[model samples]
Target chain A: MPDLLPENTPFAIARYTPDELKAALRKMYLIRKFEEGAEESYTRGLIHGTMHLSIGQEASAVGACMALGDADKITSTHRGHGHCVAKGADVSRMFAEFFGKESGYCRGRGGSMHIADVEKGNLGANGIVGGGLPIAVGAALSAKRLGTGAVTVCFFGDGANNEGAFHEALNMAAIWKLPVVFVCENNKYGMSTSTERSTAVRRIATRADAYAMPGVTVDGNDFSAVSEAMDAAVARARAGEGPSLVESMTYRWRGHSKSDRNRYRSKEEIADWMARDPITRMADMLVEHGIATREEIAGLEAGADREIAEAIEFAKTGENPKVAEVTRDVYTEAVQ
Target chain B: MNMDAGTLARPEQETRELSYAEAIREAMDIALAADERVVLMGEDIGVYGGAFQVTGDLVHKYGTDRVIDTPISELGGAGVAVGAAMTGLRPIFEFQFSDFATLAMEQIVNQAAKVRYMLGGAVSVPVVMRMPAGSGTGAAAQHSQSLEAWFAHVPGLKVVQPSTPEDAKGLLLAALEDPDPVLIFEHKLLYKMKGEVPAGHYLTPIGKAAIRRKGTDLTIVATSIMVHKALEAAQTLAGEGIEAEVVDLRTIRPIDRETVLGSVRKTSRLLCVYEGVKTLGIGAEISAMVAESDAFDYLDAPIVRLGGAECPIPYNPDLERAAVPQVPDILQAARALAGERV
Candidate 1:
């Protein structure tokens, strides 16, 4: 095996082997490629409705989810494509959902923001801010009640920390000692407002102290750092020690939505963040460790590109739901 | 005593009389005993036996794990209940007062109500929220408001107002068995009222209205505590030449439109009485349903609604009586709609 990167700190040892690192690299590449393709689809007037992209925050999504098992559950937010992809959702169905195809995860009813794969243990992505916090708590409660050894990971944005649901959910989980990990992806801005302008606390994880749970803030762009923090949190939950708050400090590369004109932040900020692209960093790490050569990294990118291209094709060719069935699924039962 | 003449046939199965509160408690007891997945979560529900004492002695029987007492955060408890329901736990969440549901509107409306539909029906939320509704005993504005109309307006949620003791038991049991979210609005005044309730597990089918008394001249549709008032008014109206039919709308949504339209067709006149506000109440929905249906042409007079006045439920007994409809208010409204002089 190639020389392992020297351990920089007590918790900084590379957790993943060469093969796992390659898989992690592939997953991140898949998320970025999928989101880029979706943006292209939206610009071309093919995809309808608005979508929140996790374009710059792939490490936070993939790293945290990588620490979870298949039996574990997660509740995601509006900008949840990366979380869903990281949690093992099929890209074809995810893209099909965005395209309003009947073959989509929600059968074309829930668009990008509401994509869910129940079989994959994703409860569902929520449109409302802080909506998934309580849901994750509930899943944890279920695991505890049933004596199931599974844990739950709740993914929300920096804005969700200010929501009442966030406070209530965390407190309940803490009091009950439910097996849940509250993962806050603190992307600098909640829409146009900066985190500093809206939030009263210096770090979002500090709020976890009020709930009496361990709190940690990690470099969200660094997958290894996020993975380490998430592993600790997950272990605490699985061990019945109660919930912990993991605030992944990150930034969003694109505008909040399709209507954004980049008016809130300077191009300098964008350029600066782009230079720290998570995918590039992972590729460099892989090369430095002799996990793969530069050619192998390019091949992985090509593979992800092909996968996204196929997903778009599948979405374009898939059938749209019948207009007659528009009123169906409103309720579990058909009411006259 | 006058309501005895209009009482529906009770089930023959070993039946015993129970107060409305006892009936509801028994329903939860049966549910918890039968299903291991069923849990009761609310404020002061464990040791305090719920704010209304509806969950008395349950915490001791099931232990703290099954009967959970939550913090004062309605939003948090409600969200946790919704989440628990989503993950296969049949949770019965009790709101100390119906008015306090305003604090949990996000979880109830945005989360619980929309989750199934928004997720394309992949999963169902089998959550039951019990709200002690209506006024009496002078709980005042903050505690006395009847907010069933708010929940009935939501699409995915099933809303039921159980006026009788038997219904209080049966409806709650049925709500637990339902595959979706259900809101049970139990009138505070009806808690002490006694009626025959069945012994074992039973179900009062939701979405079906009960015709308490059969009449011809006019129809009085009511809900919650107002159902009792309408029944009393029906007795008084019978003493007069005019006969008033009483229809207890148990389920507000999936609102037995057929039964309502059928009653309207027979009576040729309609008066909706509720404890909620007069404007945009369940009465308005009933009136609209009649006007929009084939019963519109059968109306002998314009529809009238006897609901709470456009004011908060005052703390004073006299003013509180004036704020919401009582037996006298129902009688007066029935007399006017029956084309009788005051």
Candidate 2:
């Protein structure tokens, strides 16, 4: 694919070292390859149910998660594989969950849309639009009340801005000065409706003004821009400066889901976004900055491919849950 | 044994008389005082003392931080409570009226009820939602509603309706101690009824039924305000030479199947009464439980359920009174079920 931006356009440098950049690149590549493998599995009937993929929005997920501490929390959207991988979820277990295996994160119950890793401070991925916003606020409240010094990052889409939950959670977070960062991935369309058609505000970030919080918009495809914005938001939250809205202007390279026809947008629009692929942009940046050679970047892709292949194999070999134990874990006996 | 009875006296334990609303407030007070992670959130709860003053003086005692006054956003507050519970805090969320719960069903039903099971028990939402329910204040259709059946129908939720001050305190304490989401429906009419409540830190074990009055002719299973009415009807039935048993169903979801079945086996007749609408209500579940259980063989007559009318609770006093079952309705139903009159 041809590079979309002009040469010598000043590629913003990410603050991470060469080794850390490689790790981030590997994570982004893993997310992309995992989604591709999931799509293939769906076609083969190995993975049941539909999934929302974040093909071109990998930079926002990795960049934002990189700015958070290990103890920090995040609530992700339906298109959450990128966030999960970026936040250090095991690929094998994630695949097992998607394949509905008993050894999965949710023990084969939560499939893709509901995978959660509580020990890693990931509350869970929600199927409802704007569902995670208030949950993030609650986590922030817990952090504040317990004095955990941890912040929560809430990841959502442009469509979620229209939900009443978005407004309510934002207002609550602002009033209490809860330690949370609202990350909106403006991927152009919510399902099939474009942002311009559905959202009243021109920019989703600007809605933060009504809630009395600072709002920032950045080039979501640029890792440096997303990272810098996220860093500022996280710092503000950790310092108890309340919540901030960070809108990442991004796009999805694939259709909304497997059932979607490419009738909403033109093929040219898809090609344009594909050309500005986040992984490719990072690779070019690494090469230009003399951080890594083309061969080293190629090696990262090979590593990611091998890892995803292993994960798929593990998912295929995993056991199915027994029918007799279906009713277990509905409620914890801890407080009973 | 008769001679030693006067000499062998026990020390008197401290007891106090409190209203149902005060007992609920005391339960929260004890919980908040006992646990630092316990917090209260609702509209007008802090300075306004809650919509019904059930949370009176709690804001003063716990300060505004623990007794939080949230904006009038049921969906947002409930979602926040669920999120907080998932994290660490044991938040008690109050809905001003049970009717307002319809606005917050997404958070309560989808998130709170399904999160633990969906996540394979990776997390537990120990959130308590207290809703003042039922009619009698002339609040009409919007404010007056008995929505305990709605939450009871959900699997991961524990639904309880406290009819007396003591159960109100004990059940709320137990709900706070519960690991999953618990919905407590406090009948609005019973909020002022006085009763003797035990002092400090007690739990009325959830999922158990209390046999208020025992008899041989018939069994009356009732919940919330109907429990009081059932007891009254039982007293009147005794004067007419028909003995009736009254069982107070404290928790709705767990259903106290053993207690209900045991009662039916002894009486051979069952009458389910509740304040909610009759069709597909809690009574329906109880009736179905009896019909499916081994107690079905002991039934001498058809099981009857006396519930609220199909219409909305009207603003007029007479219509509202006619909407739900009263003492006279219970007596009449018991009389006919006991084969005393047609």
Which number leads on DockQ? 1
lDDT (tens digit, per residue) of candidate 1 on A155-207: 99999999999999999999999999999999888899989999999999999
Q: Which 10-residue window of candidate 1 chain B scores lowest in summed lDDT?
A: B1-10
Candidate 2, after superposition: displacement of residue B38 in Å? 0.1
Candidate 1 residue lDDT tens string, B244-312: 888889999879998899999998999999999999999999999998999998999889899989998
True contacts kept of each: 0.75, 0.79
Candidate 2 docking band: medium
The CAPRI-style docking tier of model 1 reads medium
Q: What is the C-alpha DockQ of each candidate?
A: 0.78, 0.64
Off by over 4 Å in 2: A1-14, A334-336, B1-13, B340-342
Q: What digit string (tens of lDDT, one per residue) describes model 2 on residues B114-202?
A: 99989988999999999999998999999988889989988899999988888899899999999999999999989998877878888
Candidate 2: residue pairs that collide: none
